[model samples]
Target: MRRFAAAFAAMLATCPGLVHAAQPCLTAAEASSLTAYALPSAITGTAKRCVPNLGTNAFLPTGGAELAARYAVRKHQNWPAAKAAFLKMGAKDESSAFLANMPDPSLQQMLDALIEGMVAQQIPLDRCAEIDRVVGLLAPLPAQNTAELLAVMFGLAGKTGKAKNDLFSICES
Candidate 1:
């Protein structure tokens, strides 16, 4: 009985603990499951039935990547031009103007949760290739791009925050 108790204790000690509780980073499968529901359009009534037009630069995370390849396409285009591209994909409308240069607080947290969840689940974005393209874009954007975009979404770092350069750090641990 003592041996069994020791073994039981050992097993308990060996259990994965909080380490297992930590979620995996975003991946392709998880992204697919939430794609239809967790979109910005789903959250914002303004974009009903329409993919949120992320302007030319509003993509990467919120819209789920696939833009790098489209970079060449985007180089020849602008905000209105990007909107036209979304239209070709059966997208009908957009949420707002070029949030690319703007930011909102509440929306930013919501977006951050979505992104953190994605990275945790290893889930891809709305599309597989899109995630790839977005990573490519963000990888080069001074590391703070993601954090800045998050602040913009949250309305924290926009015209109000005044911490333009530091916005990238976002206090990410």
Candidate 2:
């Protein structure tokens, strides 16, 4: 957990616009703004379908190293196909627009969760690739890029807090 936290801190340091005085959680105004851009039902529905397949074992802490290894392998194998899909989705431009429009910390955390969820699931490599690509594009922008990524991810992962558990399930067989 310390290692993950350290890595996350490092990520924040490298990425500008995300270095704000931390708040404990999202404010009502922030949540309301996020809801305004809520993901379409179709996308959220797909996430719901995918979640169960991840199973209860998906986010176990005991298999962290093994899960990380598997995720690396899956990411390597699927990145190309996923990149093509990302371009097809026109996420590149859309991502840039999202970054320009919204730069909130809550949204950034949402994006991080989404990406982490994708890495955990390791099945929908295409969407994972899209999120990864957008994240890269947002690297130079403000930290909100990360937030937008999470919002999209939440939309993809059923927009529920429970979906975060999927991040720990990566090592499940």
Candidate 3:
């Protein structure tokens, strides 16, 4: 019995997702909203402009859910740190043209998710509002070639099919 208990404990320690599953990063409503959301108009315009620039990256099989999971784990559930890392990953104007085009609602959704994810992770909340303010002020977007950029962002957030389909729909228009 002792050996069996030890092995089970070892497995749990090695698989962070298993632990997270018991404490989901997103609430049922949030998860449903994320999956059900139609591509916003701002992102649609960006996708239309950027799809042609997809190159080989679109073929790469990276799902948004997996990326979110990795991100959730990587930041140890710290909201502010995750926001910084996202911007550093070239989400700023220096790398993404779509940033300039994104609508305020879309941006708000992303910010809300960050805060919610952090809260779900059990991060201390005393500074959350302050962090939100700072992050909003610092966020930037690219001025050109934004389709591929937005696609990557959607893919990372676990909405690859929606991203591709939306871009393709725009191309057809």
Give the alpha-carbon lDDT of every model.
0.29, 0.33, 0.29
lDDT of 2 by residue, 1-173 (tens): 11222233343333344433331233322322332232221123223334344334433222323333433333333333332222222223444345435544444445445544433333353443343333234334332333344434433343355443111111111
**TM-scores of the models, in the given order?**
0.21, 0.24, 0.19
- Predicted structure 1: lDDT: 0.29
Worst 10 residues of 2 by lDDT: 164-173
Q: What is the C-alpha RMSD of each candidate to the true structure, in Å?
A: 22.1, 17.3, 20.8
* lDDT for 55 (candidate 3): 38
Model 3 Cα lDDT, one tens digit per residue, 43-142: 2222233334443333111222332333233232233332332222332343244533456456546544433332223322343334333322322322
Model 1 spans with C-alpha error above 4 angstroms: 1-126, 154-173
lDDT per residue (tens digit) for residues 1-173 in model 1: 11111222232223223112222222222222222222221222211211233343444334333332322232222333322322222212233333222344443344334333333233322433453354445544432233334333322332345533211111222
Pairs of residues clashing in candidate 2: 58-169, 59-168, 59-169, 107-147, 108-147, 110-150, 111-149, 111-150
> What TM-score number comes out for model 2?
0.24
lDDT of 3 at 62: 20
Ranking by TM-score: 2, 1, 3
Question: By descending lDDT, how would the candidates be arranged?
Answer: 2, 3, 1
Worst 10 residues of 1 by lDDT: 41-50
Off by over 4 Å in 3: 1-95, 122-173
TM-score of 3: 0.19
